[model samples]
Target chain A: MTKRVAIIASNGGLFDAYKVFNIATAAAATDQEVDIFFTFEGLNLIHKEANKQLPMPEGKEHFADGFAKANVPSISELAAIAQEMGVKFIGCQMTMDVMGLEKEDFVDGIEVGGAVTFLEFAKDADVTLTF
Target chain B: MENLKANVILDAKGLACPMPIVKTKKAMNSLEAGQVLEVQATDKGSKADMKAWAESTGHHYLGTIEEGEVLKHYLRKSSKDEASEKKHPNVINNEELEKKMEANENIVIIDVREAAEYAFNHIPNALSIPLGELKERINELNKQVETFVVCRTGNRSDLAAQKLAAHGFANVINVVPGMSGWIGKTTGINK
Candidate 1:
């Protein structure tokens, strides 16, 4: 059975980016349709400006560094990879306004909307994740 | 039955972040303003990224519906085209981007890795702008220069370059292999 997975991102740190990318990628690999909604702080993940400066975790050489050092795609790269593999990326509209960012702050290829928009999509999802 | 005109069927199945949007943007770009691009995908993170992408970029979200595992994204292109009127090439490869950087005398290099990674080792003259702080500090850099953004490998930088280009930073570039491919001298992070 095909399952629909929705991941909610609220963290923008490297660890957060790593986790979000990994989970989303895994879902795509399993042939499950995936949708990621970045909200609040999570919006930072997609914020073209903010996403660049996320902090690396302290004393941890987990996924983020390993991915970078090993030449594996980083979260953003994985985002594109996931897309290539079949994943959807969305940014919360309400969050964008709340954060006082204009449309120019995001990357070129993204869709932006609010909770109403997200819930409309999430309502039918088989798996919804809030990370 | 769902009205085909109202339904947005975006094929982001084989693409990621900017690609989904890049595909959608292209679909929307060719259309008359106000036309909607419906996107479908399996990347769970796209759920939010799509909406945010729309909002900031002046697009409208009609809705998202799940058909089996695929989530359908409905987006409407905004009528406003004043700031984003110019059409940019949709797809850019690494070699093409590299040649441009090599030719440019004032390319701004950005490193999205942590300060430690940067301290431990980084490309020479690369600006250390961790992803988390990129937004707040992006303006600090001069947009007029050809900006080259990179992460540990190439993912974050790819996204960063796309983000910069999307925001009208016309001369931005993404470095593939990032610091991982730095053939020059290396630095170490002291803890």
Candidate 2:
């Protein structure tokens, strides 16, 4: 039984990136279908450069050190891992319009669409996660 | 002492949580139905993980034999009728990985660590493809050759290693202790 997973990536912060990739890859590795919808600030995660500038959350200055020491894949690297695991990536078009960003602003191959498209994926999904 | 033989035997000493289990799962997948996989590990928790993993995957957990500091755990692969177990095999320690890179020609080492870490310190001649960018940028590397992946430790690279294997990279190795314990020459932006 292949489970369907739909993720709403709305935060686009360091924490969110970590969570998003882990969940997406974990599900995909297990043969589960995963779709991630990047909306609002979440769209930043799909950007070429802005995603790297995401600051490790405040009050956790040493958290990144722990990740580094533990060899935790960076957020972008996690994106690659997730994709390779067959997780589909979607960037929200409405969010881009509101933020004045073009399709070229995001990473390659990420489908740019509206919430209607995302909802269609979410409709039959067995699990819906928001980060 | 009788020399031990197994369809697949994994040496996992001095490693921490998740790694032993991860490697064991990977090793088991390479075997055919009913083949035995022996895991010699130092971590105490692997004993439990092994049993739990076998149960979950429908494989038979034969049990563990403890000798001195090492524990040898045996597991029998499930029958063909059983569901397939997920695996990400082919792990390499820092020493073995470094030696292979030193000796072998046309071996590509992709560092999946973050850019900041890559800029600060990275293996000489290793390409930077941080984990987050890996899925999108996998096309950059040639899948035909041996690709050694490294991260801060082995955790991220293990994941990346699995991704590469899944993506049809015939020969993929995850370097343990990553760049943190690498003993070879490294040239980064800071250097």
Candidate 3:
């Protein structure tokens, strides 16, 4: 049976940024239908400028430096990979409005939507997860 | 990490959950049984996913070596066997087996999951002959033993049960829905 995976990206810290990208890319690799909905703090994940700089939740440069040393792909890079793997990226409209962001603020190909749109995808998803 | 050799080296760095597992599965399919694959990943989730996936698919989850943020996972192919369309007979639920265990039954439980999976978590006392190794290790199982084979989701176990039957074992039964569905008592080495 073909597996459908839906992920809700509601966090956008360094760790969470990596987590959502990793999972979305991985699920896409499985040839499963995969979608990610950006909401609340997760909205930062789709914002082009914000995603480029993943703020360290801990007050330290070591986290970002550590990622560099380990050759970990940046969240933007991982997002690109996830997109290439056919994973759909959706930016939450309500959050976008609340945050005073425009469509251009998000990465290219991010489909703007609200909770109802994501719920439709989630309803049929065999596996619905959150990050 | 430096000395590890593999037929395929999957660079899943920065990739999460299903992606690392997904890429590993694809890499594994390209190889013959017993060939090794090394996966390097950055996402922490890949640690558990790789271990669980390798066991689910019957590949040897040799273990992971971490270098800073990077996780290097090694897997050796167990066998070339794939899940067959043909059904294996007499599938039983976890409840029935739990009852059997409670009743002090003589049934022999063969865990067809990878050694990592068996080690991580499984029914207590289940034998570890991964599905990949099942063809060669069939002799290790007593022919007269009442066999119960299991995997994570029952896919590999189904294949193992059928394989045992083809090899002249008559008392093999596959555990339906596998260990993932089992709610009774369980144990493992990892926890």
Candidate 4:
């Protein structure tokens, strides 16, 4: 049976990045339906400019550098991979306005919205979360 | 009778934290503010996750309904009055930021690695809290200043970021690569 899941996000921290893909990928792997909602800081992660700038963590800079050195995809790239594999992307309108980003600022594939819009999405979700 | 309009439903299943949010953001943008957006997902953490997103981002959560095994979410766009009030999305790149806290400031660094790995070496002023324990001890974090998360690599730290972001931590940073890339001298481990 298909399960509905909703994820709410506002932070673009490295750990959060991991969570973003981990949860989405796992859900896909498990054959459940998933929906992701990006808001506040979380919107930055989906923005083309900010997403590209995700840095090497304090302690793990080497690993990231090594991956970059090896030409392996960065975390964002991996995220794209997951998206291609089947994760939907959404951007919060209020967040976009405060950041001064337009639909153009985001990557090629993303949806934008406001609170009531997201609530409608969340209302029927079997699982929902705010990240 | 209520008017019914077609909404673009995006299936974000088999994905993780930021991806869900990312996809939702995209779908909402493609839609008219007053239209409905239905998202189907399977992440166990989606319940409260969507609610908070709805509240902070200006979406009206119509409510949720469980059908068989799958759950469905219903949300509506804000009226023009509510739509004008915009908010910002805070995205912090661990590798991109250089944070320095003042002495006695409230800053916590979480090493989301195995105890053995953390015991070997970690950054100064960092706490060893594996990612597995994060959910249970999330309240330990201070929402005020800065809370940095790290792992052997960047993978786990991203997980930490998702949990902390969802839990409403205002200032959080996820260090890329985690301890594996720490260039400075390590504070000797518990060993």
Best by DockQ: 3
> What is the lDDT ranking, best to worst?
3, 2, 1, 4
- For model 2, what is the alpha-carbon lDDT of residue A60? 85
Q: A52-108 in candidate 4: lDDT tens per residue?
A: 776555777667655444333356775676677566777888878887889998777
Expressed as tens digits, the lDDT of each residue in A1-40 for candidate 3 is: 5678999999988788888887777666655789999999
| TM-score of model 3's chain A | 0.93
Docking class of 3: incorrect
The candidate, 1 or 4, that scores higher on DockQ is 4
lDDT of 2 by residue, B1-191 (tens): 32334567788876544456656756776888646678888878778877776765667665577789898887766665432332457878888877887787567999986554565468888898877789999999899988889976577788898998889999998887777577788875425
Model 4 ranges with Cα > 4 A deviation = A56-73, B1-191
Instruction: Give the Cα error of residue B11 in candidate 4, in Å.
Output: 27
Off by over 4 Å in 1: A58-69, B1-191
How high is the DockQ of candidate 3?
Answer: 0.23
Each predicted complex: what DockQ?
A: 0.02, 0.04, 0.23, 0.03
Candidate 3 similarity to native, TM-score: 0.52
Q: For residues B24-76, could you state the per-residue lDDT of candidate 4 as single tens digits?
A: 76677787755667767665456566666666566665545455545555665
Judging by TM-score, tell me the better candidate of 1 and 4.
Answer: 1
Better of 3 and 4 by DockQ: 3
Clashes of each: 74, 12, 7, 115
Model 4 vs truth, CA RMSD: 24.0
lDDT of 3 by residue, B1-191 (tens): 12344567889886545556767876877987656678898878777877776655556676677788898787877754444353886798888888988887566999987665565568888888877778888778887778888886677888899898888887988888778788987876433
Highest-scoring model, lDDT: 3
Docking class of 1: incorrect
